[model samples]
Target: MTRLGYQIPNFTYPGIAADQLFDTVVAQAREADASGFDTVLVMDHFYQLPILGTPDEPMIEAYTLLSALAQHTSKVRLSALVTGNTYRNPTLLAKTVTALDIVSGGRGQLGIGAGWYELEHDSLGYEFGTFTDRFEKLEEALQIILGMLDGKRPSLDGRRYKVSDALNVPAPLSKIPVMIGGGGEKKTLRMVAQYADESNLICAVEDIGRKLDALAAHCEALGRDRSEITVSLQTSACVAPTHDEAVADFEAYLQRNPAAEVRRAGTVVGDPDEVAARFADLLATGVDGVTVNAPANGHVPGRVGLLGQTLAPLIG
Candidate 1:
């Protein structure tokens, strides 16, 4: 059965205060938990994009926010949508997740990805390596994290990282699920097939089939069942009383952020029934989960609730 999840609005709202944004998110998470959403995911970004707002605008650190979230909500699964490999040492990152899992009673998932967004890295004085170099680092970091989580002192000497006798204390109470974010067929998909417990793709109806096909090939190469790896998609969402209202709301949002491209190629933005139907289509593609990115201020809470309350049942 496919599960439906929601991404918390962690970025600063245009006119909202940082503390207010955090409170809004915590309250929304409580509502989402009560509304039956399966997961509450947050993105790991150091700065707000110019299109979204400004770099200097308020942005919260991901793991710190997650620690707060662990205390605020009890039932929902929590995770950073994908933590960048460039941001923290792998051993340290693994230890952080282990602690979070323990504090959250084993409801944490670790989502890791190769770092992108060079502007943030440059502004923060982090190394912005070539694409290949970044991917190598990510792969090495994944190895370190997995090894540490397995309660073994792992040693690695790789092109990008060298680790010897790493220990992560207080192993996760449960086997923490590792989620890899990206659709890079060559390396990312192959790594997901080999290592990740779940994989996330940007939602694009026309391309979803193709992405899954590539993932299937990767699974075949690894001698694993494609079904063993949960499939998830990220989408921008808008829903209203009618299809027309939904489209208008989405267009209004686009108008405000003209430079921001609508990257959710496959999205459901309509009345509850129409949204439910679209989710059903995703399930047909072997998607086991959908993580909807809803707007701030409860603009579409009804729609978000409908997804978990109505759509998930239909798809499941």
Candidate 2:
């Protein structure tokens, strides 16, 4: 199981020229690789997320970044935190993930979701449909993608999508973990029970128990053991040497991005020891692990290292 994951969502670091941006990203990725993080993740969005920055902020292509990071980091699994199902053709996504797995020596996971972010869709000309429409498309996409990942040519002429014996060549060198990210009870959890190898639960800590209960019910209804799927929280950890310092770090983050707190996903903020205590509470809720983005200063040199060091032992 991947007990710890380091997510890099903020690419706009102050004072880092555009030409040197990826170098900074690579540096932090190497830090995560050397630290105890088992995975390195990036958001799959064409624009900067509202909670992170303005639309014009520097946001790179997810798969491109992952393929490049694979050369720099050996230990951490590479992936988009959650690939928007609406972003690409299902067969193309399957092929892309396969190539990433081979390039990374089989260290990759496919984290996908029912696409959100209406702005991205409306701006980029991707269909911005209702929630139901997106989920339905996601279900069909999954049906097509899973077969391809399994080395089977899948053809589907379904209500929402159609594929004609779509071929995926050069099968994955190793099993690529499939992680679905979201906390929708009826549709998302049901799909997770049926399809996913991992579930990255997205909810505040206070609500984790309820979400877990919902997921368990879905699993039971589907005749799948709850333990069969590895579960991790999509969360944030803001840590420093002291609680005050942690508070200051979060303030710094807010200054950097004034729209919203990405940490709202589920946050544990404090000194390392205090962070450990909060981590214990999150784990006690039955989640197998956590995927964390320290948006506060995560782009700063050595900042991700501090987070990994603070968290590794608790997860280890």
Which has the greatest TM-score? 2
Report the C-alpha lDDT of model 1 over 139-169, residue by residue, as the tens digit: 8998999999989899999888889999888
After superposition, the stretches of candidate 2 with alpha carbons farther than 4 Å from their true spots are 261-266
TM-score of each: 0.90, 0.95
Candidate 2 clashing pairs?
none
Cα lDDT of candidate 1 equals 0.76
Candidate 1 has its poorest 10 consecutive residues by lDDT at 295-304
lDDT of candidate 1 at residue 301, scale 0 to 100:
41
lDDT of 2 at 103: 96
* lDDT value, candidate 2, whole model: 0.87
Residue-level error in angstroms, candidate 2, position 97: 0.6
